[model samples]
Each structure stands twice: as structure tokens, then as C-alpha cells.
Target: MASFQIIIIGTGIAGLATAISLSQKTQHQILILESSSVLTEAGAGIQCSAAASRVLSSWALREEFEAVATCPDFTEIRRYEDDELIGLIPANVNDYSTRLRGFPHWLVHRVDYQKILADAATTRGVKIDFGQKVVAIDVDNVEVTLASGRSLRADLIIGADGIHSRTRRSIPALKDVVPRRTENYCYRALIPREEMLKNPVTATLIDNQSQQAWAGQFKHIISYPIAKGKFYNLVMTVPDHGDAPLGQYNEPGDVSEMRQVFKDFNETVQAVLDTIDSCAKWVLADLPPLPTWSSPNGRVILVGDACHAMAPHAASGAATSLEDAEVLGLCIATCNGIADLPRAAKDYEHLRRPRCERIQEISRENATTFALPDGPMQEARDQIWRAQKAMLEKQLQEDTPLAIPAEDMAQQFPHPALVQWLVGHDIIEEARTHLATRKEIHNIL
Candidate 1:
């Protein structure tokens, strides 16, 4: 294998994970360029589905991850008005073992997850340069110009700088591609477990280490325990009322307005809100699937939010980013020399684009489903959840396998098949198979 220099822009989850993956799988010198002077303790909660867990497991960060993460037993969807249980998605490892083969769903603080990835990447010999803002990219020459007026040349440049990526803008083909506002804003808060334990109504939430989503008209709330159950993460998504400009991602939220918006919600929800002294409001936005995720020369490629940003409804954004890193690493590791880099980049995009596009669509669809108004559509959606819940209860009571209609199961949020496709997928194996087929075809030609 030929030794090559690979520069990854940004040190977010995607960038760090890519560095770690590449360092582990290939002999390339992986360098990460972070625009920030130092990594700040920012971000709220992130739900890591089995798909991401699989990737993390391969990176040998399970012990480190589990130390700071919470493994939710299950995720429950409930009615916002009365707190009625609408549906349940089992997330216990024991349940997954019998179903999806032991991959677990994790609730983690984003800061903790990033630290783990950063540590792992550094431990594997990946060098990270801070305050290196990439201002321009010369794809033909495989070079990136930093804001400091210095230029660095590499065999490959990965634009993982995120939604407002300068590297992405430098690509002529992606000049018109931009992030579209979803017209939804979210309030994020973290409540100490000690506060929640003081109230009997809220105490039950922390008892089982389960995730809960309160679904209602034009809004929804998803909450889970993170930081090893020391704090509870809460995110309230509502219709955007133009409180903040699209350019500003996070801002101070008005606690009074937040409480008023959900005042009609059940007592349990109010109890959770009462504990919030302050919160951050984030405007939710995502990019449309680009015409392509790579430059025409294939030397500059986009990963994670830079290429396929999506709404948080599906909780697969981070997971998909991890999948990108895993697949891209596997694809690049197949190259025997610099001449194979372009083909490797093309293979990575071909293997990743469709899945990412589909997940983006699903996430938008989920936003609609989660905020359906009180009407026949909402009623029908609720009915589907009720039927599924009843079926599961009966199956548990009888200890027998009952026929579950595919259509009915498909209507449930986070549909079983979708979960299987997202979580049960083996990206590494898929990438290897893809590379092998391409090699065989090339030989035949």
C-alpha cells in the first residue's frame, strides 16, 4: 500500500470518527483540522442507535463509551395531552440479542461521545491541529488553504466541517447546495437527577432508564437519561415562530414561553418543565441531498452533516455519520496507491448516498407524524400504536409468536423493518463486498 496524507476538516463526531476509523484500518497519515481553538464542552444529548453502537464496538471504545453513556431499556411514545402510552420500542440488549443480535441503543452526552472519539483517534496516531479553519480547497491539487493564509496539500481532503462548511462551498459543483430550514425550533434542557427525584411524578422517569417521547399537535418532547443517569436530557420540538434567525443555531430560550407552550400538557410533563431554570433554543435545519457528495475529480469529499444533514426526528443523524466514517474507511483501505483514491471516493459515495437520502426522507416524515393535529389522521396514527401495543402485550402474556400484520407494524414510529435496516446493517461488510465486486469487474474489463 502506498503511504498518503489525508486531511479531514473539522473535529466533530464525523471528523474524529473518520480519523479513528482510517487510522485503525489504513496506513495513511490521518490529520484532523479543527477550526476551534479548543473543543468546548458544548452540545446536548445524542441517541446512539444500534447502527452507531456497532461502529463504536469495532473501534474498541465500548468500555469508555459505556462508562459515560446510559443504555435505555426501552423508548416509549405517549400522548401529550393525557400521557397515554401510545407505543413502545424495546431497546434492552437482551431484547436486541434475540432480535437484532446484541447491538444496544445508547443515550449519551454529545460532549462525552466526542471526547471518546477524540481520545481514540489520538491514541491511534491521528494528529489534530486546532484553529485551522479551511477557507478554500484546490481539488485538482488536493490542497486546502487555511484562514491563516497557509496551505496544506494532501492526497485526499474530507469536508466534514458541517452545514456551513467552507470546504463544501469551495466545490464548484456544490455551490448552489445549501441548508433548508425545517421551520421547527427545539428547546434543549438538562435537569439534574436530584431535582427529578424530589418530585414523585418525575421520579418514575429515572427509575428504569428508559426514553420517553410525548407526541402532540405541532410539537413533541423526547427525554432520556444521560451522563450515566446523573442528568436527564430533554428536547422539546415545536413549530418555529421566528424567535431566532436561521443563521444562529443556538440561543437562550425563554423559559416562560416554553412553559406556556406546553402548559396544556399533562401534569407529568409540567413537572419536568418546572425543574428547568434555563434552556437553549436551537433552530432545526437540514440540507437537501446534494447532486453529489464529492467533487468531479473525487479528491474532495463531504461527510456527515456537510453532505446529508437531516432533522433530529429519526435520531439517526449521528448514527449515519458514524456509518459514513466506517464505510469510507473501509473503502479507502482497499486502495493500493494514490491512483486508486478517486475510485475509492466514488465507491464510498455510491455505498453511502442512497441510505443517507432515505434516512433524510424518513426523518422529515417522522416530524410530520409526530406533530399531527387532533384529527382523523392523528386518531388513525394513535390507533395503529394501540393495536401494536395490544399485540405485544398479548404475545408477552401468552409467550407465543402471534402474526403481526406488516402494514400495522410499518405504521408504528421507528418501524421494525426500518430499525432492522438502520441498526442491523453491517457497513464494514457491505463496503468490503462492494470493493471486491468492483475489483472483480475491473479485472474482467
Candidate 2:
């Protein structure tokens, strides 16, 4: 009999959530190793979409989430240079999420959201050892060597360490692993609502209640409300068309550097530059599609950002990560705990790989859909999108800002049922099919 239990080697959102969900399947001791002292977020805002909301509701944290998260009024897409409105995604003061997923899509500050998740896990008896960085590990023995000189072992090890995952390297099942930067450089900052309100340029770009996106050649700038409309989150992305050196995201830039990156953006967008106190420039990174998400020996597994780091265009990263958690959670529950850890790990890899790969493809293709290069084709595409949107808006309410409110949504859409399945039941069937004959799907892609 193995004295080793479930050892999770990171305390990120994906790691913490894994511990919480797995804790339910048995009384097996769970240990979390987090490198950072204070568990906080690296970014400002995140759009937790329907796919994510469904899983969240299952944890029965809706009321608690509602208390901290903001349901924005819109995600109106537009042209970057001219600021021409192209598509309006309604996000108003309604239960639109409930329409899509019997719940809602929430845009919350990263730290605030992480706190919600962290608190829930700790309250449920997950033992999180913070301030402990993982230095190395011996996968065969299922032992983890911590930076603090403590050694821990487990029957199962989870590599939720993130994109630069240490455990991902040890898995013979997924070698030739390299995280490529997607040529998207993002500059992000926060603004006080009062300051944003005073500027005509900024005001035109966004109100306190809605989200705004202006698409350009190979890029876009988007802003939205957070912290109960007290502050706004803004992100501007541009084209490099070439990859950056590994770890360039580690550097922070001042406001001057940010302006230079988006120099050709509209004047309204420039208003953000003046009011911006500071900013961070990030070179987004992600892994190529893998044939399997499991170790050949079956003691280690990958999840969340490590497995599927899609482009942020569709706002699907967080959503997909939660989906990863749900699939792995159900797998453990069915297997009867860490006692069946190997089987559960294999099941998790099979269920998630294809779904995650599809999402990755769609996300990569999606970024360019709105921001085509400047030329004749760009103008024509913009005009067609606007014409189509105008045709659709005829049936909607005008007071509904430029973005689609959940109420304005087509009642027959499939978003709601998906949501229902996400929150109300186990998606064991879908997971099984995804990983079904996983070898064929891996080669096909």
C-alpha cells in the first residue's frame, strides 16, 4: 500500500481548484506547494465566460461570486483606426449569463477573483503550504523537492505549475515541449472612473458600465468596468509578427513605452495614455498541441494554462482552465480518490486534449478575425460585419447600448443548455468521447 497521497505542486487557480475538487472524492490528505508568499494574481481583469460559470456554480459559489464580480454591459467590437462599430455583444444589467448558462458571465479583478477561489479551497480543508518554491522532483518515487529543503511524496503528482511547468518536462509522454509566444504584446493598466469620465476621448471609448473593443491591423484595444465601476481595465495589443525571447514578459514598461506601441490608435484611445500612471507589457506564450496530457508512467498530469494557453481573443483562457478543473474533478470522484490516482490521471488526459486543442485553434484564428491587416479587404470586411449587425439589431432594443444584453440574445441558442450541463451535471460522456481513441485525434490535428 502506498503511504503517498495526492501532491499538487502549485497553488495557482488551477492548482487550488484541483485540490478542492479532489478533496471531495476522499479523505486522502491533499498538499499544495505555492512559490509565492501572498497568493495574488498577475493580471488585472478576466472574463469568466459561460463555460467557466457553469463549473463555478457547481461549487455553489454564485452568491459569493456575485458579491465581487461585475456583469458588464457590452463587448462591442469595432475598427481600431476609425473606431467603427462592427459587432455588439450584449452584456448589460441583466442575468444574461443565466440565459447563456443558467448563470452569468462575470468580469472581475484578478486578485479579487483569485481570493474567492483561494478562500473556498482553504475553508474546505485544503492544506496550502505557501512561500515554498519547487526546486525539482523525482517522478518515479513521486517525490517533490522544495526550495525550503523539505521533501514530500505522493501517489499522484499534478503539474498545475503553469506554462513554464517543471513537471511538464519530466513527462516522457509530452517531450519536444516548448511554449511559443503568439506575437501578441499586451499593454495593460487601470484608470479611476472619475478620471475616465472627464476625458471626452476616453469617455467615447468606454462608459463605466460597458466593455469596449477597437480592432486594428493584427491587433485590438479593449476596456471594461471592474470593482463595481470604481475602476476600469484596459488592454491594448499590437503586432510584432515575430516571436520574442523567452521570458521577455518579465519586464515592465512605463506609460511612454506603451504609447509608442499604440501610436496609430484613435485619439480617444490616446486619452488612456495621459491618465495612465503605469503599465506592464506582456508577451503571451502557449504550448503547441500535445498528443497526450499524461505521463507515460501515469503518475503526473497537466492542467489549465499548462495544457491549453489559447490566445486571449475570445476571452476563453480562464473559461477553459475551469473546464479543465471540472473534467479532472469528476474523473477523481469516479475513481474513488487517490487510491485510483493513475486511472483518474489517464482519464483526465484523454477527456481534455481534443477539447483543449479545438479551443486553442479557434482562439488563434479568432484574434485575426476582427483585426485584419489594413487594406481593401479590411474595409470590405468591416462594412459587411456592420451591415450584418445592423440587420440583426432591427429586432433588438436600442436603449440596449451598442453591446448585446443577455435579454436581447436569441432564445433558441445552445449556450443555456451548455451552461445547465456545466453547473447541474457531470459531463462524463463528453469527456469520454473527447479522449476516445485519443491517438487518432492527436495525429489528425
Candidate 3:
């Protein structure tokens, strides 16, 4: 019954970023549909690594981001049992930004970040339809049918929906592709900064402005400051039995029971848990790698978690999604007309798939590292961290740039290498080069 040049499903960060990016390049009419009646964030904190920060800055959101995000001085890894420091990675925001011409790694509440993207989307005149549940889609026809029986067509349809993407099922090839349990569940909690400062156990962490993590047998806890240190976000991940009913990602977990899981943790970790008045339990799910991210016809495409959902171990989910949007926008803008949509869609998938797959694999591996039970493997990992820390400290003493490319880093620091691979990438520039090469090839052909 309605039409547009582009229809983006889901209004999360990815969807909004896509709309904004596309609108900036061309006057394509963009519509974003959300199943929820309201635009809100149920998630907790999110990391905006250097790559994502650069994307946001390019969108003229630097001021907005600085207001909502905190740049921690460093990240430390400690043993969960006795809290012995294993490693410390200097996260000097200023130094990195200056050397790389990129923004610092930032921590922010999810809601605040979403607000920034949503505001940017609206300013770009992207139409957003809330409470519109897409029940079915026809990728070949570039059409989607709403639960209310309304059908809409677009020149191109983008599935930016989250992990449980309904739009993903529209592609016949992905109909059977469902997200499976990663056997990890998490308790996400946010503590007010004032409250944290009041407690002696949490005060030192807050005072240092350091992001910290404790690795134990079969579990880990990550804590950091967000909202410019107005609040501290803590995420605790542990193995679960996949007990939640089908179609359910989380259930209300009792605070006492949740605290008990970390009962044997170090005093600081347990103390932090004790202060948690409430928390949300989330079961981590990930999609097995798909053979393709787009339909054969290329009229419909998947972006963000729809195509490469992964465990949150590497903390690159949002960054990858943002990169996907940047690439997708670049592809669409290269199109000469509606007739070129299919080719452009194919280009987007080609440019994005490999990197996304690598991210998914690394994130899964990182989850294993975090939840490794006490054993030789865990001890080896800790030793690697200690060696890397010593190397980093030597570099600092020698007054050298702390930019160690993943390939150049010690083998035990694979997760950091994955992270370095992510933050060091310039997706926009990559997209430009890719499209430019394609343009030459097209002309020759």
C-alpha cells in the first residue's frame, strides 16, 4: 500500500545509522520500521571502539558522543579468585586519538547512544514507523508484509533487525537459519556513580576511571563507567543449560541467586554484586555463519546482527553493525538508478561478509577465553597476558606509540588482536576503495 526508495527494518543503532548514512549521500526516501510501539533501549552499556567513534564523528556527532560517553584510562585483567592483576592495557584516549586521527574507545549507556542515532535519523528526515511488525517478506519483489496485512514495496529492503530478525527469515536460503545458544548467559546491571563511590570496595575502581574485568573458572565479570561516570555498568557471564523456554532470550533472575553464582569470586567482585539492587538475565545466542547475506536477486539484504550475530565477548557487535551501515550506505549511493539496486546489494554483501565472519569467530573465541575453567589452558592465557603487559610497559618506558597491530602482538593476546583489527579498520575508506574498483571494472566490462 506504500512505497519508498529504501525500507530499513528495526530502529536500533544499525538501522538509524543506515538511514542517516544513506540520506546524506542521496535524496533516497528511507523508512525505518520497528516492532515495538516506542523507541527505547532495554540493553545496558555498549562499547564504542575507535572505529565506531570515528563513524559517529564523521556523522557530526562528536559533541553528542563526548557528552554521553566515558573514556577510561585503561583496562585491567585480574584473577577472579584472589584478584591478582594479570595484565593492564593502557587505553590512553588522548594519545591514541592523536596518533591514529581516531576517537578514543568509549563506554556509554545504550539508551544514550540510541538517542544520538535516532535524533540524527529524524534530522535527516528519515521516516520511522513504530509498532509495525513485519510478518513476512518477499526479497525477490522487494516487498514486506506487516502483521496487520499491510504490504509495502521498496526499491531495496534492508534487514537491520536484531539477532531475532524476522526479516532474515524472508530470504528462502535463511529460512532455517536460527540463532543457537552459545551456552552463555549474562547478568547486566547499572550502578549509580554516587552509590558506587559511597561503597569502599567500588570506590577505588571508580576513582581510577579504569575499566576492569575478572576472569574465573567458568565465569567472568566486566565493569566500567558510563554516562560520563554517572553510572557504572557491570556484565557477568556464565554458562547456562539453555533452560529458558523457546523464543525467550531472558527471564527475571533472582538477585540473590545471581549473587550466589559469584559467591566464590574475589571480595571486590562480590562486594560490587552485593550493591546490585536489580539486574536482567540474558541468554547469549549466535547465528551460525550463513552461506550468504543477501538474496540471489540482491533486492533484499541483511545487515548488523541479522547476518552476523555473535557472542559479545569481543565487544564489537555495535561497531560491526555501524560498519555494516556505512558500507551498505556506500553501496546504495553508488547505484545509478532503481535498476542498479540489485547490483549494489550484491556489492554490499561482497564487501561486508568476510570481515563480519571474522568478527563472529573472534567473538566466539573470546567467550571461551573469558569462561575457561581453571586448567593449563587458563594458566597459559594468563601467562600470555602477563608477558604482553610487560612488553607494553617496556614500550611505555621507551616512549613509543602503543599501537601494536594484532599480527605483531604475542599469540596469547588473540582477543586484543581481534579488537585491534576492529578498531584499526577504516570502513568508510575501505568502502570507497571497493566501490571505486568496482566502478572501474564495470566501465571496462
Q: lDDT per prediction?
A: 0.83, 0.69, 0.80
Q: Is candidate 1 or 2 superior in TM-score? A: 1
The TM-scores of all predictions, comma-separated, are: 0.94, 0.85, 0.94
Q: State model 1's lDDT.
A: 0.83
Misplaced by over 4 Å in model 3 are: 1-4, 97-101, 402-417, 440-445
Superposing every Cα of model 1 onto the true structure, what RMSD results? 2.8
Encode model 2's per-residue lDDT on 325-370: one tens digit a residue.
Answer: 7778666555533446666677777667766776676566656765
- Give the per-residue lDDT digits (tens) of candidate 3, residues 1-445: 1233789999988898888888776778899999999886865788887878888888888899988888876688899999999987666534753354356778889999998899899899999999999988888778999999999998788999988888889888898898988878888888887878888888777666778989888889888988877888988998888775534554666799889999989999877887788888888888888988888777788888889988888788888888888888778777666667678877788888888887777777777787689989988889888987887677767877656564322223344564566676777887787788873334210
Worst 10 residues of 1 by lDDT: 402-411
- Output the lDDT of residue 352, model 2: 75
Among the numbered candidates, top lDDT falls to 1
Model 1, 146-252: lDDT tens digits are 89999999988998888788788878888877788886989999988899899998888866588999998899999998888788899899998775788566688
- Candidate 1 TM-score, true structure as reference: 0.94
- Where in model 1 is the C-alpha error above 4 Å? 397-412, 440-445
| Global lDDT of model 3 | 0.80
**lDDT measured at residue 159 in model 1 versus the true structure, 0 to 100:** 86
Candidate 2 positional error at 104, Å: 0.8
